[model samples]
Target: MPNSKPRANSLIELHKPKRASSVALVVPLKDASRECLKRLARYECPSLPPYPKSQAAAVLVGLFVGRWGDIYVLLSRRSATLSSYAGDTALPGGRWDKTDASLEDTAASFAETARFIQIGLPIDKRRVPLLCTLPPFLARSHLIVTPVVVLVTDPTLRPILNAPEVDTLFSHPLASFLHDRAPFPLPSSSPYHDMPWGPTRVRLHSFLTGREASGTKPIAGLTASILLEVAQIGYGIAPEGFEADAPGQASRRERIAWELSRAERFVEALKREGIRYDWTKEERREREKRLGRDKSRL
Candidate 1:
């Protein structure tokens, strides 16, 4: 039998992801906090006027300065033991608990579990401070997810690996999301399908990041979508060549607004609005064509 520690190290070497040679950045280490604060300061996060606490969800966008001064966002691979979305890459967060005073609190509390347990990061409030929340995003599950941005200040943090809920912890370059040119090795090779979401088609992206620092997995779906927005917001710039968002499209706030204006619950609203947030036959075929393959999940 092989030693587990050495086996793990060998796996990391086997899957090391391609490093981006040069990624344009407006959020360098020194300015990561300043730039994010400045950008978010100008914009107001819109409230979902209709949903109650039971319907709210949140995700923590934990950012830290890497050893080389580039800005990175923390991610985790859900433990395969989970019933749903198991083994998928996700930002640390979950549905809002009744005890949570606000979505930001829900995001922060979950983040503490993910960061501290996964990496042995200390419980010091000074190390991880919630910056602000972004506009709410409707998850495929129909619950609205609010991304709470936080900056990790300590650089010398060590690995702890005690996470029972997470199989691995990894970081991705925040700025790489802005470019369509495959800034981080995988390029657009990540399988994707432009699924119909209403009047327009939105891309359902699946990025294979290879074996990254700590542990890594493919990032896709709403998680990928959220990071794209975060990268744009943190840097105060749109994606380089492609549109991060469709031009003149109704803002996500506006999309959610349509639900509030109606009496329908979010799930019902998607059905009533002729919106296909999940893949239908249209997307299934496209995905197969794109990937030349696939699977089924519960």
Candidate 2:
């Protein structure tokens, strides 16, 4: 008859030989294997931008990636009471000053703006990495802007906004902009005040898209073009058709177009203030070149 009762330790020992306690036990072997597989499957590519000439003026391009794994780009809506780009959406950066040790330092200074505005937000100053600097860009204000790229890991960090400099804070998810079906048409008129692809947009685009895109429409300026470039990178798409604009080739009209599309309210406000603006032939040629057009007329 088969035995029904449970076997004692002695009975189990009789069936198997005891191993030395010195034998190491391997635990979570499957988990370790999975980790190895993940590591083997993942790859990284270095993205670098050409360095711009040493300049007094510069801009900061802050990028934030949330816990949900979604990337969100931050921009500021200037107060209507300010002089330039008033009430328009722009990046949280400005011209570099003598006190700034480096472009990275200048970009990080934005944290002070947050403090002044009493937003009670803190930025992890350590995470700001200087990716690369593009050729210096001359804005309508005759200021050459050196754009710097930075990554923000903590999105919940509240920002202390400068009441006079920044009126409101805005953010847009990268996923929303990447959708192929979304209608991201260029604005019918100028969006912002004087900026076509405002500093924020331009920097964001450069980081997103490795190269620039051209042609007259809303999303034609450097900023939008850069965003498109970044999207291409995230999707691992080859930037075959994208072009890189030459320095001083961006046009004032293109800047105007970008501003109009991005923030019509700000543009209207500037017009109400009777600000003078114009687009010249040379400016158009320069802009076209910056949009990646060559000397050959297209």
Candidate 3:
């Protein structure tokens, strides 16, 4: 029989991307702290109207990239049947439990859940160091979400997913997110005027870039707020504008450029009205067609 350690190493070796100037960062568990939980607990809700309060935890899982010289975040589409935030793109995490001792414990629980869904890659838990936690974000359902940032090493630990909670998992390269062409403009009719961009995208944007949006949308709410904190820690600057074209619109540079120019003003219009969106709900619904599962647990 093959040696387990050697076999594991071999499997890891197969998926490792070639060395570049920027490599994915992995922090050791010993260096990780659960202090972010305190900030999460104390975070004040954004200016939006308040809702009932519940507590939840999520992990801002990231990988180091050689080309971008920074960490990239991992995002996933939630199953449509969940009680809340159905079919939205988000980080992996769920409600806190009474048995959990701390945010780290809650994170571990999700990691295990990821494993159960077969999305748990053999992450070197020890090497994945905890960075910091963002302030808690308030969801529409009043779920106060605590986001924990962790750096992962070991390229061999490819994601294995459970289809029920996660429809698909994708990585947003820091470079792409930081690229000038990547920002999405806010719409005018959005319900979240103070935060033109919805919370999740805003959080992802903020984590990728440090600065917050200059417009009325202040990157409020749970996901966006947490992303803002992550961006501050990582890049220290936010991208100036939305991506030039719809994510899947066209591959041509000219087309992308035209779309970006048009989107800049449209985004402003959205900001004026407090609408924050890149794609319409219809777009999200259409994408759901490609995702196989419909049911999820809260």
Candidate 4:
């Protein structure tokens, strides 16, 4: 009798990957990619390509076209073993080392980042061009994460998880972030205002994804925010329900400036607010616990 066994890659095989047939089919994606580049170019100034006062970081936003003309973006769940931002969805880059002779050399150092994202796909440089970058975001760890968008035209690609840095690799519809209702199959919601970062807050989104029934943790926080801007520009539309920024919210550049210029004052205020210099999110946890306790009164 012949043995009948399921393949080890059975889970990945279950979901049909979206692919493009020809150049004509990818026009929507190409057009959107061009739109992102054009919109970002408008903000070009001397102060741009914002390098953080803290350690410089970056996240690669990989965009590609699917079969039916929808734009998709690459995302990954951070490894559970990670010390920070673990379980959250994220882009495929990280804190780039800035210890170099010149800013140009610093850019050269980022060539090393390919090692971080060199998963089983065997990315071809000809097909994947590192193109425009979106505005920088100031992370809780004090790193200024520049959002770099890249267009992937190659359809003959399959990605495997780069364990340690990533737990699972997934793709989400890039344009869906601009929609009021998230087009995810799994349960999803927008702007879950659970926590406030110091005095400011950003629009947070969450989606349940992956093969599991319960769903992954969430695509919330910085990752979601980055995609929102991408979708807004890429599709030339604003998010439906909520405004992008709250009133009096300090821009990421402004926040970074304050952090750098008033290092002593910032540290003291953060410490008083339980945002330790070590960057522990103590206030967030405490707020959750307090909310839980308050619910008991009802």
Query: What C-alpha lDDT values do all the predictions have?
Result: 0.59, 0.40, 0.41, 0.55
TM-score of 4: 0.67
Backbone atom clashes (below 3 Å) for every candidate: 1, 26, 33, 0
Against the hidden reference, what TM-scores do the models get?
A: 0.67, 0.45, 0.47, 0.67
TM-score of 1: 0.67
Comparing 1 with 3 on TM-score, the higher-scoring candidate is 1
Candidate 1: tens digits of C-alpha lDDT, residues 191-250: 456666553456665555656554566678889888888777777787665655443344
* CA lDDT for candidate 3: 0.41
Task: State, as a TM-score between 0 and 1, how close model 3 is to the true structure.
Answer: 0.47
Where does model 1 exceed 4 Å of error? 1-44, 102-123, 159-162, 182-192, 212-216, 246-249, 258-298
**Candidate 1 vs 2: which has more TM-score:** 1
The lowest-lDDT stretch of 10 consecutive residues in candidate 3 is 1-10
| RMSD of every prediction | 13.6, 18.1, 18.6, 12.8
**Candidates 1 and 4 compared by lDDT, better number:** 1
